[model samples]
Target: MTTPTLPENGEHLLARATAILAKGSQIEIRNLVRSLYPAEAAFVLEALEPEPRASLWRLIPPGVMGEVLIELNVEVATALLAITDRKDLMAATEQMGADGMVDLLHVLPEPLLSQVMESIGVHNRNRFEQALSYREHTAGGLMSQDVLTIRADVTLDVVSRYLRLRGRVPAGTDSLIVVDRKDSFQGVLAISQLLTHDPHTKVSELMDTKSPGISYKTPSRDVAALFERRKLLSVPVLADDGKVLGRITIDDILDVIREEADHSLMSMAGLTEEHDMFAPVVASAKRRALWLGVNLLTAFLAAWVIDLFEDTIQQIVVLAVLMPIVASMGGIAGSQTLTLVVRGLALGQISGGNARGLLFKEISVGLLNGLIWAVVVAAVAGVWFHNPHIGILLGAAMLINLVCAAFSGVAIPVLLQKIGVDPALAGGVLLTTVTDVVGFMTFLGLATLFLL
Candidate 1:
């Protein structure tokens, strides 16, 4: 078992690194991995075959495993789950940070989840279960339960003493969570500052008494947003009883943002995030088909409006050809506004305090944009259709649909947010339906009045 020279590409390097482990040569692999950067090491670890990968479980130490697990995808985590026994799984998950464990656990089945949860110590089990109990998108679910804390009144000597003790500051820990004697959260202390502090000082002597923390029940999505707002490395999580339960770290928030951003992008296009290699091609198609069905249903509403103007469309072939332009423009504009509103909600903006202002802002934007596009497209259509009258009709139709699209786009998400609904879920459907309806009606109705 000797170190192999690095390769050119990530995949080639990853293969060579994984090959060393396959030959049961951990000593050489560990040394080589330690020398390489974390990114390269992560790729190597992720590329390993399941059997060899799990073998690293006993070979590599917790510190290394923690870093590697953070880089692995759900598929690789699933592979790890299949090969490792429950006890080994628990140990490995514990070695990883709390939030990392949650992310991995989310990729497993119910039976495995419960089994792993049960294998940890009672205290660890409690903390893990409590985090698992949180709603998936809230702050509580994504936060870790392993932060260090101290009473505000504690002297600098106590803080210094505790830190010097082995395992008091866990390796790979996010930050120290400061607390009152009653276990109420007080502030956050970074590891750098704690190590640098004088032996005579107390934690209470530190400044910034007002630290940002969340209730244990806050949504994980909200938790991620809080981390972004405060620019914190970690934020302490507390219970209603004021006991400090855990902490949320930037690492967890980064994953949350990535996953949520993916989910939002997919859902807005009416798709879910359940596809995988194990999933059958038919299964993936079916899941996608369900959303396509929703779109089909909504399309009928647009079709019915077109049917209403069947007489006019038949009389003028130009009306039939130009029909798609109005709806397409409105749909695109509406999607722009809808995407902004929905993303704003995910980021914890667009609150009741500013809903009225946001609404006004969207309407103003719509009016300005509608006027600008109406002029541009109208001139183009006038030249294309070779009729000033047709241009007038198209311009008015564009203005009507754009205003409607923008208005409905903002309104739909706000209404959903108001009703304790997720602004991200189903927002696209409602916005599209409204835009389609307006687009069809405005175009054909105006044609019937003026063009006919």
Candidate 2:
């Protein structure tokens, strides 16, 4: 008997699911969903609009729903959770990891959360509560309580025998964590060593003591960095007194990396990482309206700057024609610097010791570029307007605006971070305001003084 193969890519899966959904066959939909990985199923669900999404959701197996829910975007997950029965939700989550359950509880309604809490086993409930106590964006929240550990004094034979009795360990358990009698983390014993070594060897002799346990309070972003730099498959989370709390797997780190990437991309447009593409129209509009309003205010401020130089513009119509070029060039130059600084901040590459060096380097680049482009623009303006004075004014204005833009580009993000504002969200608006005002004031001010 031959079975069918599912497409590996999400787009193909979405297409197949959509086709099946259009046919409105419950059996076909259930078969399609049941065959997919939780993440693939989640992709198909998110790709559908609300009505079809609900239809597909009902077709997913109850055991896999918790996992699929974990894979979904926050808004989508929240929406799905709202319609699910509390007892059914608890049943779905019974086999879920403690960390995943904690995340779900946060988005669940108060009544649903209470019902689920009452239904879960006492040990699982305690772990969930512990995970929930920590900030969501920290190591503690991301760590799973289902850690497999061994005493440092145990022999490899004892470890192997104990593992055989337990049946199976959690996924991503590349090494067994070594702990002292007090449960303080000692080191790790690799599974390869456990399988290959002479059974008589003491666990303490073969354990890698150099591996460090991550502090529970560490930010999730920093934790992701550690995983990246160290190439860790799994790392132990430690309490303040050095007791082991849980383990953070590579899977959890992947989620953190995805979230940070999403955040950086969205924040530039003043949007949240969890923003749902298929969110209701009014809700989406409300979120975007605030950002648009902020941009409008900046636009008005730039216009006001130009209004002050209206007399110069009216007299020499060429000045008005050439004005936008200056502002546009300045804005582009500033945005390049701003993007670099924001990324540096996100990667922890920018620090107090090196920030001044980066600023100096950016300003120097601006000066060099401004000088080179200034001559080209000046020559173009002179040839086009048939006025050498207009050329000189345009050149000087370009140089001033570009230099200011470069300075603002580097300075704005740094200033925003110090004041606890997200540079990605606020930096573009502020940078545009600076470039427009300076570009207009410098170009038109020069023309007013010399050409007028």
Scored by TM-score, the top model is 2
lDDT of all predictions: 0.73, 0.88
Model 2 weakest lDDT span, ten residues long:
82-91
Q: What is residue 86's positional error in candidate 1, in angstroms?
A: 6.9
Model 1 stretches with alpha carbons more than 4 Å out: 1-107, 113-136, 171-175, 188-198
Stretches of candidate 2 above 4 Å error? 1-7
lDDT of 1 at 433: 85
TM-scores for every predicted model: 0.79, 0.95
Expressed as tens digits, the lDDT of each residue in 67-165 for candidate 1 is 565565655655555665555555666676656676666666788877777776898777666667777666666666666777767766676677778
lDDT of candidate 2 over 249-358, digit per residue (tens): 99988989988988989998999978778999999999999999999999999999999988778888888889999999999999999999999988888989999999
Model 2, residue 240: distance off in Å is 0.7
